[model samples]
Target: MKKLFLLLLFTVVVLVACASPYDPAPQLLPSYVKNVYVRPVVNNTNQYGLEDKFTKAIIDEFMRDGRLSVVTTEEEADGVVVCEIKRYVLQPLTYDENMVTEQYKLWVLINVFFIDKHENVTLWAEPNMEGIQIYADSVKGGFGGMTEEEAREYIWEKLARDIVKRTIKGFGSTGGISERKVQD
Candidate 1:
């Protein structure tokens, strides 16, 4: 009985020593930041009207999340999200026997930053946030595929979700391009 008791005690000790303590919900954002304002997107690329659509998408995403209030003005917000559309590249990925493009890859790159309104400082900046979609060109008759506009809408949705997730879930939650290779 004595030996059994010691063995049980030793097992319990070892188990306790090997166990790791983890907090299920580690606080990622400051408590004071409850409202965020998404500034109008600035499009640096030559793609026209991309800023408006992307800006609306991000704002809609934040509203849909409902975790933080979306404010119209900077003064009313505790945080501000600034976005710049850096690059838009659409290229033919696959071609048919007649040299007709069948599939195309559309990639959009943007730089996003979260700024602390109170401190007037950027908390985080994702410089190479990118969204890409490869699809069959319906115009090229690739089995009734999607149009460029449709593919762009898909990209916007995904990037918007990623932006919202990054904001709500904190750093390292979403992945983006590490280094930009887009040249002038």
Candidate 2:
């Protein structure tokens, strides 16, 4: 009986080890959502012109992706992408011996929603979507560092890519902030 039990345990272990890894297929957006209108991004932070740059980045990303037609008006679109810049933070990550900031971290937080205009329902909502970058100061570090504007541009590109991926690939591509932080 002991030999039989050991054999059974070994068989179970072998079967488990031989099992194929599960990979979930990416979920695509609804077939009806062939076109989208990106509303002008709203900036809540004191930073100036961030809305324009971010909005342009998103538009450019959609155009580059070629998966969805970008429409000029909501009426012409099957879906609408709503974006709002909620927060922007720049902090010193490391300081030099002189107490000067040598390295900095930039963070941009946003809320994104893709609504099915025909159904009058939001198909997907990403609240507190964020893009972050860390770099050394150009004057203090060995490697030439990016200016604040350059850092902002980098963040815009990252966010635009994420937004596009979330729209085209649907769930599990990216994670938003904790649900507890999101308010109605």
Candidate 3:
């Protein structure tokens, strides 16, 4: 019985290892989409300088991704990514001793659109998309915890990655992106 169980386990492992990876979302954009320009994000919320941070993050991410080329102008690019900051909110999440705020959450709602410059049409749009992060506050005000700017940076990184993934791999993708190279 032990010998049979071992054989069964080995067979299962082999099958699992040999199985192909699945892709949940289809490639909606054409293969020619290589050069991309990220527009300066418009901020509707009252948070000063927040849009600039998000825009810079997205540009830096696209340049680092290596799959898409980041261009300086829309006229010179194959596609453009437009973003708008719809809302920003910071709320206290946890309380420590004496009802002091210990943890806080930062949330932002954004609208995004990927436009094909040649076609002059939007390839896809994600409106009212939200990103959030939670961090503990410093006890004394400058040491062992995260500040508002740090939290925003963390959230910006997350949003930028998601935007790049959606634009390159297609929105709502579940599995890993199969294609790695983009035509120049």
Return the top candidate by TM-score: 2
User: What are the RMSD figures for all models against the true structure?
Assistant: 7.3, 4.5, 6.8
* Collision pairs in model 1: none
Ordering by TM-score: 2, 1, 3
For candidate 3, give the lDDT: 0.83
- Could you say which candidate leads in lDDT? 2
For TM-score, candidate 1 versus 3, the one ahead is 1
Tens digit of per-residue lDDT, candidate 2, span 14-87: 89988966666666788888999999999999988899999999999999999999999978999888899999
- TM-score to native of every candidate shown: 0.77, 0.81, 0.76
> What is the lDDT ranking, best to worst?
2, 1, 3
Q: Candidate 3: how many backbone clashes?
A: 0
lDDT of 1 by residue, 1-184 (tens): 9999999999999898789654354326667899999999999988899999989999999999999999999889998888999999999999999999999999999998887776666666788999999999998777859999999999999999988887777743333312332111
Residue 156 of model 1 has an lDDT of 90
Residue 52 of model 2: what lDDT? 95
